[model samples]
Target: MTKHLSTPLANSMGIQDQVSFHRTELAIILSLYGRMVAAGEWRDYGISALKNLAVFSVYRRTAEVPMYRIEKRPKLRLQQGQYSVVGMDGKVLRRGRDLKQVLRVLERKLIRAVD
Candidate 1:
């Protein structure tokens, strides 16, 4: 067998890379995270890169489900945008082409002062 080292060959062999958030994407997300942390709204977070999507989960406390999840799905980029914010109940809070815009849904909740 001969070796075909090319992009087409790799694709033909079904070599798919996992989708992940870029450094800049994470930076923006983290900026909000930092603010939430300081406000005591969020205590922990998790990141997951899967075959079709990347997820950033925010938690108020450990050992429980995430309060919110930010997901990036390139497959939906052309249709309904890529960035999405999901609530803890698994509902889509916001979805948009711009990450910052989708992220604003969460930021709105942070605007109020904690009693």
Candidate 2:
């Protein structure tokens, strides 16, 4: 069996009362990715789980900056809300405590006119 290294948060920060993505985060992010792919709006994506944050970045092309970044920061869980959707310019489209609500910002992009 392999041993896992402990981090500062695990050894010191202890249990945080703040909310996080949990399992549903993956489902929500993946669902959005699928729709964006089908719409031909997104070509690539990346996920990052940092010490204090988690980021889901959507890219139209590999070299260019991500078109959108869905981030989860537990430290800002209460102050700015845990979930946030940011645009390419790093502009926050939405931030809230509810994951579903925070994700709604992206869902709006999926809407199209019946032409």
Residue-level lDDT of model 2, residues 10-93, one tens digit each, is 568674443345687889789879998999999999887776788889999999899999999987877989889999998999
Worst 10 residues of 1 by lDDT: 4-13
Clashing pairs in 2: none
Question: What lDDT does candidate 1 reach at residue 30?
Answer: 98
TM-score of each: 0.85, 0.79
Per residue, candidate 1 scores C-alpha lDDT tens digits across 45-65 of 999999999999999998999
Q: In candidate 2, how many Å is residue 82 off? A: 0.5
Give lDDT per model, in order: 0.94, 0.85
Clashing pairs in 1: none
lDDT at residue 31 of model 2 (Cα atoms): 85
